[model samples]
Target: MASEKTNGEQEMPKKKKNRNEELKLHDLLNDVVSPILFPEPTNSAPLLHRIKTSLSRNAPLIPQASRNTARDTLLWTRAGSPLRPLLLISVGTITILALTGLLVFTLLFLFATINVVIVSLLISLAAAAGCLAIFFACVTVIYIAALLVAIFAISTVIFWTIVAITITTAWIGFFYTVWLVTRKSLGFAKQSLSVTSSAISTYSAAWGTRNLKHD
Candidate 1:
């Protein structure tokens, strides 16, 4: 029961806030629409009619062209007699000069553009030639360097081969010398042994003959 009372109290404030928001929205709409529906009256129509009547009554009686010429003549006479013709002539002359200047400037611009294009083309050609020359030079240098590297490699190989050949020759010569010395020593020892054996056998045979005679 207490919880229900508290829930009802919370819902009451939300409903009141919604009612306030709706009332504010309605007041804003009324304030915006009231002036458009009921605008204040003005005296502009009478003033505009008075202006049209005054203009029609005070308007010129002469044709428009004659009126303009009359006005121009009056102004010219008040200023000076010669100024009117001079002004017309000067305006025409200025227009002619402006057209001539425009034509001359166009021709000059075209000529300058052609010259610029030609100059740029020539410069590009020169630059391309320079680049090609540099490329060829680099290629030549690379070829020369490669040739030098190949020569160096070949020379190193030849030097090592010569060293290997010299080492092999020295080894062969040392072995041959050792074999010759061993062969000479063995031959001398065999000859001495054979001579000693023959001498001993002859002495033994003489001894045996002497003994037999004595007996």
Candidate 2:
């Protein structure tokens, strides 16, 4: 009986040791590989260390003050130019006003010609009735016909003359304005280009000198 009990005791200790080894293996797996497979937060030391190291190694290159200065220079240069907007607004306004005036004049002249034709026709009819019994009826008819033709011709000439004058004047003004604006824009562009070129040359020379000194 004693020998049997001693054997049981020995087997219990062996089983306990095996269970402790298995628990230790489970703990090791949970620490090293379980997070990859099961997404459970056991510890964050490794992740935090990686983040800190990355931030320390790769810092931002440009300083804040230099960045602000570059932005301010761009803004100031843009703000200093006033002629471009002014030219655009002036040209647009003039074009619209000229077109409107041309349209108004055309409509008014057309209506006036119609009214003149109607009045002349009414007067010719009245004279024809009054002179129908006279000996000069035929002559009167010829005179009235000629008068009507002349009136039509005169009205047509006047209308066309007005139109031609208006169109020519508007065109002349438009072209002159365009030429002036173009010349101004070209001058501005040349000046801007010159300034940009000068700035670039200066920066390049300074950079070259800096590099030479470093060498």
Candidate 3:
């Protein structure tokens, strides 16, 4: 019985020591890791300062003349005058055409590069092996003929001719096309608004008749 009491006494202190240690660990975690993950007010002030500093570091350094030009451009675009729409349409059309031309040229160059490599390989094979010379020569001629046909097909189209035409013709056609489309769109919009107004008037008249009968 005495030995059993002594063992129980020893276990009680150990339990107390373990509870104290756990409490200290919890306090330490709350002080260190908790502040990092969900920062305290004191830490948040420094974080905001750091963010401001980073944004300042990355901000652009625009020159005064460039800034004034950008401001003027924005103002002109927003003034809602005839010149504004004309300027916007012209810029957008030119940008689209330039991008399209660039894409076409890029694809053409890629294909041309591949064709050159294949032709060179064939030519090398023909030179090295006597049996392939006639085959390579015929292939070369066919390739040249195909390129000519492609160029002829492209240049023959009216739309394609616009690319080679003088700037005056291109710009005039661009404005004419835009004007036609705009007029069509405005006519459609007017018709839609008239139809909507008619429908609403009919609805209101029907509702008034029903309400009068009930009264």
Which is the leading candidate under lDDT? 3
Question: What RMSD does model 1 have?
Answer: 52.1
TM-score of 1: 0.37
Q: How many residue pairs collide in each prediction?
A: 0, 0, 0
Q: Rate the local accuracy (lDDT) of all candidates.
A: 0.58, 0.60, 0.65
Which candidate model has the greater TM-score, 2 or 3? 3
Per-model RMSD to reference: 52.1, 35.2, 23.7
Clashes of 2: 0
Winner by lDDT between candidate 2 and candidate 1: 2
For model 2, residues 40-157, the per-residue Cα lDDT tens digits are: 3754557656455444533232243345544654565568544434444445455565666566556656765676566566666666566543434454466657656655665665
Candidate 1, position 15, lDDT: 100
What is the alpha-carbon lDDT of model 2 when measured against the actual structure?
0.60
Worst 10 residues of 2 by lDDT: 57-66
List ranges where model 1 is wrong by over 4 Å: 1-128, 210-215
lDDT of 1 by residue, 40-150 (tens): 475334555645544453333224434455566567656864444444544445555556555655665576557556655655566658875566556546655665565
Clashing pairs in 2: none
